[model samples]
Target: MVLEEAYVDNQHNNLENVAHEMDGLLQFNTDRMIFFRNGMQSALETPLDFMILRKAEQEYISKRHEAIWSVALHNRRTLPVYGVSDAFIDKDPTLSRDNTLSGNELMATLELGYLLRLTNNNRGFTERMLYVSRSGFFVSTESANKHHPGAGAL
Candidate 1:
């Protein structure tokens, strides 16, 4: 109701102020708008499928968060990830569009484990970090150790 009244008021005022406000919003978050529009389009295209996929992804994330990793025994372990979507985006927009469409199906599958370390010696795990790619691929650096001068052997 308030929005309708505002629309009417804006219309009466030639929508100059409302247009300016909209311009400000778009300028501030253009990339966010793109993401929002894409999401809306996907939802509209396949509401049920999108909801189911999102629910599955949420469940996976929840399970991961609930999982308890023994840091004492497992200093750094590689956990396999299944069905990871893999694709590369070209820097040139024209070349990318001509070669492949956006949001294409993943070509290959690979098992990549995320390296997790125990920051503190406690029952619960905390202060954990993992390096991941934009497409959610974990980059493990367990074997590769940095050597510093005056550092004792581990």
Candidate 2:
């Protein structure tokens, strides 16, 4: 899912750091699951099947946060859902309409419980440091070495 108009949080201030934090929180070894993407631009490619938007400059933080959560909860789907935006801090009238339409589509196509399972239990598995792949999934260098010792040098 592409996180359009995503910006670095003032606290984090670095896209790479944010990505690392996300990986730390989301990677799972037991299930061999990982959420992977380079940065904001490439985040759209992640296979997790959902996208979350950062609060826009003009919007109320609480309201935007609640709205996003609501959309995720109500719109459940097997396929990934993406949250698109145009800027980090600007009036983008299109976001509400886009989210609404996407949410509806997701709700129609997915089961509510399935989406919840993915989101709520994201930390259920073991964590690993990973590298993002073109396919938008995380791959661990250590895991690769264990499986094929010589592969690291290739």
Candidate 3:
């Protein structure tokens, strides 16, 4: 509703924030995903399929929060995303078609770049935090470490 209003009103300011707020609250919300997964694990004998599906979802958030290490070090860079559906001007004609297109593209780039830089290396970021088990979809990190004493050590 608010997002549609933003576009309808040509109010691009903080549009990405609006999108994020909506996404954070509803569509990609993860508040009880872990809790439910834990419940499912306790309930079922064969939870691998559930875990696999949940793992993919967890990966979306975990990998986003992963440290970039070096943005340049990665051979495969995340491509910039353009999410704007239509021109903000809505064909007012004050700006040439090429200029409007350029402006829209630039706006898309700036917004997406801002989002990527923040999310790609932000750990424990509340805005898009992962509530998954520390060891991932299967078991608690404590249980994982109990089996090995130290799960990821030499």
My TM-score estimates for the predictions, one after another, are 0.19, 0.20, 0.20
Model 1 residue 103 CA deviation in Å: 26
Measured with C-alpha atoms, the lDDT of residue 27 in candidate 2 is: 56
The residue-level lDDT of candidate 1 at 64 comes to 32
Local error of candidate 3 at residue 86 (angstroms) = 60
Predicted structure 2, TM vs. truth:
0.20
| Predictions in order: lDDT | 0.34, 0.33, 0.34
Clashes of each: 1, 4, 0
Clashing pairs in 3: none
Q: After superposition, which runs of candidate 3 have C-alpha atoms over 4 Å from their true positions? A: 1-10, 45-154
Per-residue lDDT tens digits for candidate 1, residues 122-154, read 223334434443332332223222222321221
lDDT (10s digit) by residue, model 2, range 1-154: 2344343344456866889878876554423433221222232344334332222112322333331111222333222222222232125432333443443433332332233334444565334333322211122313234534453431
Model 3 worst lDDT window (10 residues): 67-76
Off by over 4 Å in 2: 1-30, 34-90, 93-96, 99-103, 106-113, 118-154
| lDDT: the better of candidates 1 and 2 | 1
- Residue 136, model 3: lDDT of 18
**Per-residue CA lDDT of candidate 3, range 1-154, in tens?**
9989978767665676798798877644464455445444543543224343344334333333332100111212222221111242233344322432443333333223333343445443344322121121111112223434443331
